[model samples]
Target: MSENTADVTETATEGQQQPIELPADHPLVKTLAAQKESIKELKVRAARADELEDAQKTESEKTADRIAKAESEAASVPSKVADALRTHLVALHGIEAEDAELFLTANDPELLQKQVDRLVGQSGKRKKSNFVPREGNTSTAGASDERSFVRDFFSGN
Candidate 1:
């Protein structure tokens, strides 16, 4: 019975010592306690805002990368189209390689043909190289004597 009484008194003393009161005298503590709910709400809102900002940055970077890739591809399109046009003119139209550039800017077939004729006429004005062997050197073995066998091989004998 005495031990039970002592335990009851100790519990009462501990309960008395533990006061469920805020530090009312401290202004800062009182303010923080008063605004605790609002502070949590603000923190949550701030975190959400930061998350949204980071997401926007990520999306913007991705968009910028996509735009950069598109710009690069766009820049090369003209050259690719020009090369295809040059190939078509050279293979199908029998335009000279040196005169291909002049026809690239021409829109219609008639204009392109006119440019081709102009280029052919200009080519006629230039003197031809005398590299062609004379009729006397028609023999293949004799032509080999005039030029090196390697040069003849490379020149498509």
Candidate 2:
């Protein structure tokens, strides 16, 4: 009996840390306790509201909701695919991601390529030394480039 009592007390002590005592008369403590109680009440009310709303929903209404959600997700797939393609094209063309996002909005990769090619072909501001390297020997290759090379696509000659 004494051993069991000792085990119980040990467990209780283990569960507790030393308390940081604040005066109960403190206005901040009072407000904090009030807020805690208010949170509990609000949580209860929200749960009850959800339960009532769920109870009010018919089987058909739930099915319709699921269908609508699925439809919305389905509608977004093309946009996601196009965005992925755009990102790939941006990296491939050595165009800045921000520049592509701002200047290129077309869904067609070929069209976006043309747009990027035009931007690269037009802008003579970018120096040979300023080429953003993509693949091997780009620095050595771009350093001797004639002119008209885009960001960094100096493969042969």
Candidate 3:
């Protein structure tokens, strides 16, 4: 009975000596406790914003890549079409082989035709409406009178 009482007294003394430490006065502990909730909320919002930015960046890159590929394909089409157009134009222009080769190598057909037409018109071969002489400027009576004079001069009686 005395041993049990002594053990009980010792346990009670230990419990009394080991006071429960309440976190009421530590500034760092208080700050950390207060910041924990806000930090978790901030982290969640930041993660969401980062995810949205990543998704937007990925979409933009895909669109850019698609546009670049389309442009490359489009560029190739014009070269091939231009080559076919050159062949057809070379035949239609009736140009000498060497000159046609030079023209096809150097210029587009429609552009060459425009240049040729411009130069040809400028070469004075084209008829001008204002420069053409009038046909019936002299009267028929004047011509007849001139003819009688010529007949009299030629046939002396």
For every candidate, C-alpha RMSD to the true structure in Å: 22.0, 17.9, 25.6
Clashing residue pairs, backbone N/CA/C < 3 A, model 1:
none
| Deviating ranges (above 4 Å) for candidate 1 | 1-57, 96-118, 121-157
In model 2, what lDDT does residue 120 have? 74
Better of 1 and 3 by TM-score: 3
Instruction: Show model 2 residue runs off by greater than 4 Å.
Output: 1-22, 26-28, 96-98, 106-157
Which prediction has the highest lDDT against the true structure? 2
Query: lDDT of each prediction vs. the true structure?
Result: 0.69, 0.75, 0.67
lDDT, candidate 1, 1-157, per-residue tens: 4665576678688776542333457666678777998899999999999898767787778789899999999888766665565567677766655558544465445555566667667767895777756756555565555478677789997
* Candidate 3 lDDT by residue in tens digits, 81-157: 66677666556655456755654452454665565455445544655566547675765555677788887899994
Q: In candidate 2, what are the lDDT values of residues 51-106, reduced to their tens digit? A: 99999999999999999999999888777777787777777778886777788886
Tell me how far candidate 1 lies from the true structure as C-alpha RMSD in angstroms: 22.0
lDDT head-to-head 2 vs 3, winner = 2
Total clashes, candidate 2? 0
Rank by TM-score (best first): 2, 3, 1
TM-score of each: 0.31, 0.47, 0.35
| Global Cα lDDT for candidate 1 | 0.69
Compare candidates 1 and 2 on TM-score and give the better one: 2
Candidate 1 lands at a TM-score of 0.31
